[model samples]
Target: MSDQVDVVVIGSGINGLVAAAELAKAGWSVALLERNDLLGGFIATEERTLPGYLHDTYSSWHPLFVSGPAYAALGEDLHRHGLEYRNTDYLVTASVADDGRTTLAYRDPERTAGLFADSRDGEAYLAAVNGFLKIAEPFGALLGSELRSPSTILKGLKLARAAGIGLLRDTVTSGRAYCRREFHGDEVDHLWSPWLLHAGLSPDHAAGGLMIPVLAATMHGFGLPVVAGGSTGLIEAFGKLFAELGVQVHTGTHVERVVVEGGRAVGVVAAGRRIKARRAVLASCTPTALVRDLLPRDAVEARFAERAERFRYGRAAMQIHVALSEPPAWSDALLGRIPLIHLSDGSGSTGIACAQAEAGLLPAKPTVVVGQQHVLDPSRVPRGAAALWLQLQEVPFAPAGDAAGELDTSNGWTRELADAYATRVLDRVAAHAPGLAATIRAVDVVTPVDLAAHNVNAVHGDPYGGAGELDQSFLWRPGPRGTVPGLWHIGASTHPGPGLGGASGHLVAQRLLG
Candidate 1:
């Protein structure tokens, strides 16, 4: 049987959902297809550990989505469809050093600055945030718009006018260099460096010069937010919105190929049936998937196909969900209040861990992102129990050796290996939160291998989709145009890199609507 739609969106991730919703609202008939029995890709929640204890299976934070252009356009509409956010006011985020010294950033600039030992560092942090805000509009423009779009040039001009050539000069500078120059002491650096890991980058990576300050400014501006229930709340709202708009959502149906006729994506073969797209086809998939597996060999030029083949995915990552009997007894009183805390000494420690992971070694002391969701929304856990959302962004998908030289890497991410690594990570957390080991009810570990199995687009368990390196980002995001005429790429693998921003989807929808 054959069916027709104005647009056929493959993969019901954030990007795909955004595109489908936007198009459907704009008077287009859309079909949202997914391979899994459920939608939302990694943006899902489940009782992974125990009944009644909800956990975000993958991405739990909503900083990017809350502040992104897609949210700006769809936020009101989504909120009307049963979407709710549980956010913090003063105690936003904090980082703990190996020495047990904690660096905290709050919603208020003055309050956050006061946490630094050196008063000058506090002043410096505030100044840096203000300085970035001066050029944030244009900077956000560059990030939000397509690299090849004329608006990018206009935004570039606005940025140059606001910040001067000095801003452009730092494009090649590493994040570590930028942080060192901006802040006076390790306290400020320690607080923001590990955040680079979220952007699929390390402290030493290029473009940190811009990202480091921008991230700080953004956090201060729009403190981290989470769905009231879990990450699933956001997608579930989208599902409701889609249904109201009459969008045909086909879950558990895989698109075997993006059929191309006359050098354009005409339709897709899914469920052993050809579903024709009357307008455009948007793929929220990896460049490799779109170019090699889906599209015809001649759909794109040979050169473009070669570039897709060479598309590099960033380091592997893992998520560990810990069901606690009660709230952790943090060593620091201030840390217990903060919702999100990083158990790392800042740039120095995270840099070493990234280096080790890149060298195919399990980082002996990996950076552990301890997300205490129960701090803000008590609904996630039952009664007094707390849920811990631990994220390890720096890990090797296929380990060649262990940095601590204790684990057996010969088996490569086996169940035993994943459990051992989770134990090590939990030990790190236990150092900061005494008696954490005893309070644990259950542990669910999603290793790099497991991440790949869950979402093939992750490509070797890279949650960010692909590398956010200077060359691979912006204009060079696997090239400016899609492989086929009527085909479009709107996912983390595309420009603007990863995260829940959904920038790529918003951009494609705007173009198509225009």
Candidate 2:
């Protein structure tokens, strides 16, 4: 009994951590293993940026800040955990056409509406948000409720209730349709379109995608907040819980393979050692990495592997972080707040950006996100210095005409690509913030290939697991079943898409327990 435990989880990312945490909370001992030198998939920190600067290597904003059960459950009361979130309540969104028309979304929607009073769309903004939230009520319940019931009679009722609420139909429409029908402004639509990226689809595709409001509600409920340190803080908080719970979180360990016997997972093999477990095995890695590399081919059904391969991994990002002496000055007060920014001057920019990789066009003006992390959390940057992350879409995982385009881990080109991407952000932001570039002291960049090489969870450089479209949802996600009697999967790649909410992790674990 001493040699064995209740469960063995591979990868210390949020999915693995949460699965372990949930099981341990239920009085089960667990042994969690991470291949990487550290824990937390994308919610990680890197000192590589500079000596004192701590950059959230992947992401800083948690759209599910309010609605995510992980944060909601964890609450502000860390109880000696030393974790706190400071929110930047202003969204400085602008369209850089002949006229740089910028709109501000305040913590207060009414105030956000004031910035657009002259525009008809501005007046409708509040109402549209209200309507979206109103429609979201039932949809929220549908996502939260257990879709499975012991009896078919109960399951039928759940289905009926969901369909009656118009959830079924709306979820079957594209994001473009949803936005066109709900909001009446160009910028509002531009602002709302970011949600489509979550699903890994262009707004134009008739892919039956309508999950924008859930994301909006999550962000609105709590402005996309970040801890004072970085994303690593969130992951470390879980590590702390694992320690208190006595769950063994081993770092710097590489899991070579998943140990399976008699048609069921038994444990894992790492560092030429076999760590056996009696309870169960949970894989928090990518479907491809888990199946192709970690697990034996025959152990996992070929159909499952095929499905995992077929799954669409969404848009790639070319990211850059600048260690600046001063905040970039903008055409407007972009320095004031706003975690994410959008572009607005294309026929179907949202959809076009989504299809750009396939179409072979590096968009003239791609969706650019300007996240001034140091502005929101000063602790992340060195004293008298700031860190700004600027990421552009359409930077495909496998770009054409590049030798090391997809997951380029071969040469020194990754850091170089990162630098080039950073320069673009500096220039674009400088377009409005004329004085911004002059203040820059140092820059750190992470290209699409860099992201994939670093985190096995984000295959093909897509940060949000698989495509969050209608085709890869709920039961259809990854593969069949929430938990396969002895196996479990969780993370941003799974159902409910990515972000800090850890709601997917909670649901996956809850499903296992239930």
Candidate 3:
């Protein structure tokens, strides 16, 4: 292979794949380099527990990707390359409390609202969602474009004129506060509050109020989708598209540094070889890594480097995959049919767990995201067997103590600690599903340490890139461009934050193409 290309992408994550594929399709020679032996960064499917059980090791849902502009641009190509998705037409998600009370959401917002006990709250819920949809176009434009660009400024102005100052106020309000002010009942709060964790925010965070509506409208519109067979099918499709486009893919090759000359990133040194980039070098990595390790000391100003240094990571996360002899017999039958369910009671419980995690203590009752891929695609498991993708969002990356006061954390995520925590999580699940423990054939626990080891972008076990807090998000996000002319950034750390959505990569690719 030639030691040069039009672009050198320094990671094979979803963002990197999207950028490389888009550019290559536009007739640019792109060389994608990855430090790992695999192409997909966090996107992987494997049978961690037992044979014949395919589990999405990390991120499993694709609602963000399916609804984003990246899919609009590449969905056809990916589908043609053997990508298939399975989605629920009705029941999308639900949340269950410890007392067996359940709140559900469906593809029809009106139907979901109708299920609420207080009729006034139901009306308020519908109104909030409808209000968001009116501004969704302009809001989406700003999110999918460069925040400081002229187009983004115009979009912001359009949104302001359309919604007035209320939009700004809602953007800064906490989800907990929004729920309290808008709805009288706890149903709305129960259903959407725990979702803030998925955006790397606590219920009390500034942007949760806005994010709650976004999540609600997104799920109601797109429904929850999981790639057929396994999440890796999406990656496999991307690989096929890359091959057909003649994009050079170099896995197991570490990019040591960006070779900058005359204040431009001309190439990258990967595995002791110089691979030149004639157009651009897109580093789908954390800002911290880009400033502190990848680029030369003088490549960027000291202030920018310091800002990167201060890029904070949110709470850690853990994944527990369970292979069951039979499906979990949830006490509430509705939960059994739902694709994903949250074991949270909205802001009341979720807030406390977030606080515990932030204090460096393992949440006693962490929010458990129960993902049942087998329900949507039976091919994931054997004939009658099932699997559970249990995700723990409120976890301490380096626990100082256990909130339950039952596990020792002095050694930091030791196997014993992880196992104990896993038991705690399973016990919580068992409370709702009495027969859960008996049906578990095997369980595999992935700690925060494991997550950090698997993906470099998962800095300190923060899977959603860096913290999605107000200060480091939106216009303040790191970059699609640096001081260096040809250097660019994408991935979870960049604007539009983290998700399966390839927005950041698509945005940067469009800019380069333009």
Candidate 4:
């Protein structure tokens, strides 16, 4: 590899890959470096549970990615390079109460409305969907644009013109408040409230009211989709495209520090070698890492450094992957067909779990996101076999105690504790799926501590980068511009928050190229 390049990307997460691809497409020489031997930061698949069963260990869904700007620009090239996505048909998603009742959302809006018990709520549901569709254009633009940019102001003006000033106040309302004001049924609230968890927020969180409608419209517009083969399929395709673009790819190399001289990031020191950057140095890292550990002490002003120091991270999360003998048989048949179902009971259950996690206590009943990959893509496992992807979003990074007082907290996420917690999660699933316990061929549990150890960007096991609170988002995002010149930030920690969407990467590339 050359001693210098036009850009040096410090991480190989989705954002890093997207930024590198876009910059290289614009004819800028780029070098992408990763500490882990793997390329994707949180996207990976493996037979951890049992051989021949491919489980998406981290993030699996791609509705955001397929619908975002990055895909609009690079989808053709990525698809041409062997990135195939498999999606469900009618059943998009659902929520199952503890009593075995289900609330489902279908691709057809009318069909979804039919699931509602009350006729009035059904009509209200349709109206909400229509209202969201009316404003989705401007709202999406605002979410995807740089908050400090003039285009953002124009988008806001367009939204205000379309929806009126009242909508602006609605944007700041909590999710719980939005549900109460819009609909009068528990069914609708139960169905959509759990989705806020994906954004690293609870039902009581600020800006959740704004997210609820968008989340509903997104699911109704684009159903949950996964890679054709496995999560690794998309990353492998990215690797192939990166190779073709002649971007130097370095894996398993630790970047000790970003070299700063004369108040600008000129290069990065990795493995005791200095790789210079002529144009820019992009760090797809948490603010904690970039400001505190990587940059020189005098590179950033003290006030900015203090703000970075106080950058808060949300609660921890864990993953429980199960290889099943056969597909789970749910009491409600609708749940059997849905690709993703929340075993959250309802919004009340979800709220309690989030509260418990934030308080440093292990929730007795965590909202279990039960993902059935085989329902859409059967090739991931053996014939007639199934794989369950369970995401536990409500858990502490460092446990203080268990709310149920059943597990040991003194050890701090040891293997025994993880296994015990995994058992509790399985019990929750078995409540809805009668044969789930019997069908389990193997189980693999990953605790929040395990997650933090896996990726440094996942500070304290916050998988969405950092908390998606209002303060850390929008114009307040740490970068695309940093305190130090020639430095930029892109990743889940920055604008537009988490998920598989490459919006941060796409946005940063546009700015650099301009």
lDDT of each: 0.88, 0.64, 0.92, 0.88
Q: Write the per-residue lDDT of candidate 1 for residues 1-514, one digit (tens) a residue.
A: 2399989999988989998999999999999999989999889999999998999999988888998899998999899998999888888888898889888888988888887878988888888789888888888888878778676888878778998877765677777888787677787778888988988889899888778778888888888888998888898899899989999999999999998998888899998899999999998899898888898887788888888899999999999999999999999888877889998888889999999999999999999999988898899999989999999988999999999999999989998999999999999999988899999999999999888988879999999889888888888895225578888888998888788988888889988998
Number of the top TM-score candidate: 3
Candidate 2 Cα outliers beyond 4 Å, as residue runs: 76-79, 89-98, 114-128, 135-138, 144-166, 206-209, 401-418, 479-484
Q: Which one is best on lDDT?
A: 3
Weakest 10 consecutive residues of candidate 3 by summed lDDT: 148-157
What TM-score quantifies how close candidate 4 is to the native fold? 0.98
Model 1 residue 86 lDDT?
89
Q: Whole-model lDDT, candidate 3?
A: 0.92
Q: What is the lDDT of residue 16 in candidate 4?
A: 91
lDDT of 2: 0.64
TM-score of each: 0.98, 0.87, 0.99, 0.98
Which pairs clash in model 2?
Answer: 172-208, 329-433, 330-433, 331-432, 465-493
Total backbone clashes of model 3? 0
Off by over 4 Å in 3: none
lDDT of 4 by residue, 1-514 (tens): 6789999998988899899999999999999999999999999999888889999999999999998999988888899999999998789999988877788889888899887888888898888788889988887788778887776788889878987875767668888888888787877789888998998889998878778878888898888989998989989989988888999999998888999989989999999899999999999998889888889988989988998899999999999999999989888877878899998766799999999999999999899999998899999999999989999999999999999998998989999999999999999999888878889999999899889999998888999888887667777767767578988888988888788888889998988898
Q: What is the TM-score of candidate 2?
A: 0.87
